[model samples]
Target: MDTTVAADHAKLAEELPLDQIDVSDPALYQQDVWRPYFRRLRRDAPVHYCAESPVGPFWSITKHKDIVDVEVNHRVFSSSSTLGGIVLRDRPADLELPMFIAMDPPKHEAQRKVVQPIVSPENLDNLKDLIRGRIRTTLDSLPIGETFDWVDRVSIELTAQMLATLFDFPFEDRRKLSFWSDASTALPYAGTIVESEEQREEIFRECLGYFMTLWNERVNAEPRPDLISMLAHGEATRTMSPREFLGNILLLIVGGNDTTRNSMSGGVLFLSQNPEEFAKLRARPELVDSMVPEIIRYQTPIAYMRRTALEDAEIGGKTIRKSEKVAMWYISGNRDEDAIEEPDRFLIDRPRPRQHLSFGFGIHRCVGKHLAEMQLKLLWEDILRRGWTIEVLGEPKRVFSSFIHGFTEMRVRISEPR
Candidate 1:
């Protein structure tokens, strides 16, 4: 670290006390040492403030109940794009893609309803066979005795395939969905995924152009069950502007891919780290139903969501000013003991597994929550049925982003343990 930057961090930590804690640093997450930092905040300052950081000044809502309070009270804690959108960082002005998750009430509902049916329970049931088949083929292809990147072979591939199916995109080029999701959320300066903001925008334009061709086709043809067709024909979304259309498409693609992909990889890593939990799961494969939420809870993809205050409000003894950015740290809250029993443990068959805040709460909760859960449930059920086992071989390389809580690489072997 630069001397000035290090000195500055120290100065802030001293002067601001616990208020100076900035959990948004990507390095904190990448190193997998963020637990202690959040523990400090939850114990001393559940609604603490950091006057400055890479993303800028913001409040960290660390405890579970406090985060849910921010999520439910939408009127006071606005998620409007006009304020700042959902991430801890502000969306680029020149490239603001106004998706509904960032908007409030009626507009959010109207736009969301347009494409919501694609992942409805009935549709999910219809798609189960296909998802299971794909998962089986991908797992069966792995070499049993040799190590391979579980992320590339299984995690990314399954999620990307599902996303391609959702968008009805060409299956051969499906990895492009994962590529686009990474480029869209990653910062160029972060040195993690994309190199620069201009390059990132260029990739996004290509994504939009590809989708536009599909949009033109869908509008001219008969209605279909695919997402593009639904958006092209739905009364609420058919007349959307190019920016709005791009926003919605990006939202669906990223929302549909990243969470499940990481959670799949996270599940293996967590189990390997907690062998007793794995024993419990393996002993009773039927526990797959309960295991799904525990995996999501332990992984906690998309760590923190940001909301801008519409008015002054008091939370945890601190007063938040209007227009201030307040982050609901779902990752921290999921591990908050006040909201869960032994929040740090990785038990697979906990009685109240879903009690954690992974899918979030209230209106803005993840739209694909059910689908993501189903994917994990089915993945585990298939793994157990085949009597297959995986051994984590080495330290996992985590995604270098505070927002996308996931793995970039994890070496694993599919053979039986010695």
Candidate 2:
């Protein structure tokens, strides 16, 4: 965390007010020293307000219970794009793209149901064999005893393959999905990913053009099992406008890519950092079941989800006025001591590990939650079954976004295959 960019932007003096703290600073997360920052908030001011910052003023809800309260009460805090959608940065009014997750119920529920069957129990059962096969194929292809970017070789590859399967996207061109997902969330200030807003929008436009080709094809084809087909044929979603469909396509792509990929990449790095935990897992391989959820909790892929106050509401003793942007910092809540005992440490086996907010909660609680978990569970199951262990060769290059909390590259080597 040497001279981190976040600390510089969020310059604070000893006497500075807590409202001056801006957790939306991407550098804090990029440097991975946001623990103390969030810890300070949870201890001193659970529902603190930042009067102003790069992404604008918003109340930072750091407590787990408080975030859950806001999530469950969607009426008071709307997930509508007319307000601000989910992220702290409000969408441009002129270019507003409406996705089902960003919409309230009735319409939201209607659109979400079309894709729900794709990740349902039966669909996961259908996807399990495909996911496991990809995991096996991907791991076996890694070079033995050679340093490589785990995020590229394993994380992105596996997740992108799944995304391609979901949208029935072209396998060779599947990397485009990851590219668009990255571009969608990369803030203009985050120099590491997309350099500017123009660049981001250009990538997004390209993404829409490519997906529109598939949308046209899917609309004519007989109903299939993939997401695009589900949306094309489903009663509620089939009538969506082009931009609305593009919005949902981007949503599914990002949702499918970020969380599981980061957890996959992060889990390997975690074991390397905690060798004893690695040994413990090797000794008790069944812990992968527990470890999967713990990894999701630990990494907390999407850092925060924003909601606009629909009415005057009180939370954590703060009176949030109507139409004010309120950000539920899921990353902070996942690490809140009140929520999880020994929140700092990454313990593979923990009681009620799934209680964390990695997949979020309420109506917008990740439609692909089951699919993401299956991808991870099958991954570790394969790793443990083969008695292989990966060792981190260098520190990870994290994604430069407070929103999509994840890795871009992680150097590692296959250390043992006994």
Candidate 3:
């Protein structure tokens, strides 16, 4: 081997421990133990490889610039159906349901256009009042001076309702949709994977079966405002088979549900830790608009997204071979020294908050980005306006998955209504 190849092997050996980096613990996720490791990778091995069980080894892309390059140049580094899924590890055959998030362009663009308008700014503007009302009702229902699970009460409730409204699904069963989405993204150590997978398929069938019934009823019916109605009646740019429709619906639910849930939980945690910042927002509620993005930056709910190389390519002076998997650590990228000033600290009024990659970058970026922001802003505004005091009663529990980093349980005490 050449001298350069020897050095690359040495570097890879040194960074082999990244394969053991477990994100299942809340403390590890909160304190961010991976930041230092990512910083080293960004400095020495921007395109380092690691070997692991189940799925073997894959390259780790830590630098913000490199991540953007791979994300933007989807032609070379594609999200195709044949190259496995978009996740770091290969999913079980039973649970392998492909969505647009894992598809390359032409097809991806065709499917994306179907639901894009429903989540656009104009449509979101129409939803502001309804969202605000839901927020108000959620806060009002919280028991005063008693500890309760904030994750379930606040985050899940809000996002679940938003999703239910988006799909025109029965409001009462919205939580079931959230449950299935959460299960579909289970991590290696999240022991509930097997059970969750079984349950997910059942829930999906139930939900999709109902939607199909609705589709039949609405096939010849007038165009309704909900996403399902639009998708059912829209031009057939890409035909959505029953399986594909269920997969995409499940994708939207998981995408819209978990990230926003984590952001809401993270927002409350930030407020509890930074009382001064909370007070600043309470004093001037208009700041909630900008504060939403700051919370996303600070918490980075969706920690990382994995992509596979379709062909051999060079990034940040390193060559990635074809069929190699690459994990984009968004949590570390958001706090990249080159990306933002005082990246560690939570600053509500930070200028250029949208610069954060929390919603990701390029064509594969989140379609519900605007909707998530509106929900966060409205929730914060509602909490402040209602004169609520959110006290952290205990330590927050983190999810076991690296893909969707969020709270499983957050005990909190809400003060009485003033």
For candidate 1, lDDT tens digit of each residue in 53-90?
98899999999989988999999998888778988778
TM-score of each: 0.94, 0.95, 0.89
Q: How close is candidate 1 to the true structure, as a TM-score?
A: 0.94
lDDT of 3 by residue, 136-234 (tens): 888888888999999999899989999899988889888877777776676434456435455657767877797788777766789888777777876
Top candidate (TM-score): 2
lDDT at 318, model 2: 87
The lowest-lDDT stretch of 10 consecutive residues in candidate 2 is 6-15
Global Cα lDDT for candidate 1: 0.87
**Deviation of model 2 at 365, angstroms:** 0.6
Cα miss at 283, model 3 (Å)?
3.5
- Give me the runs in candidate 2 sitting further than 4 Å from their true place: 1-16, 189-193
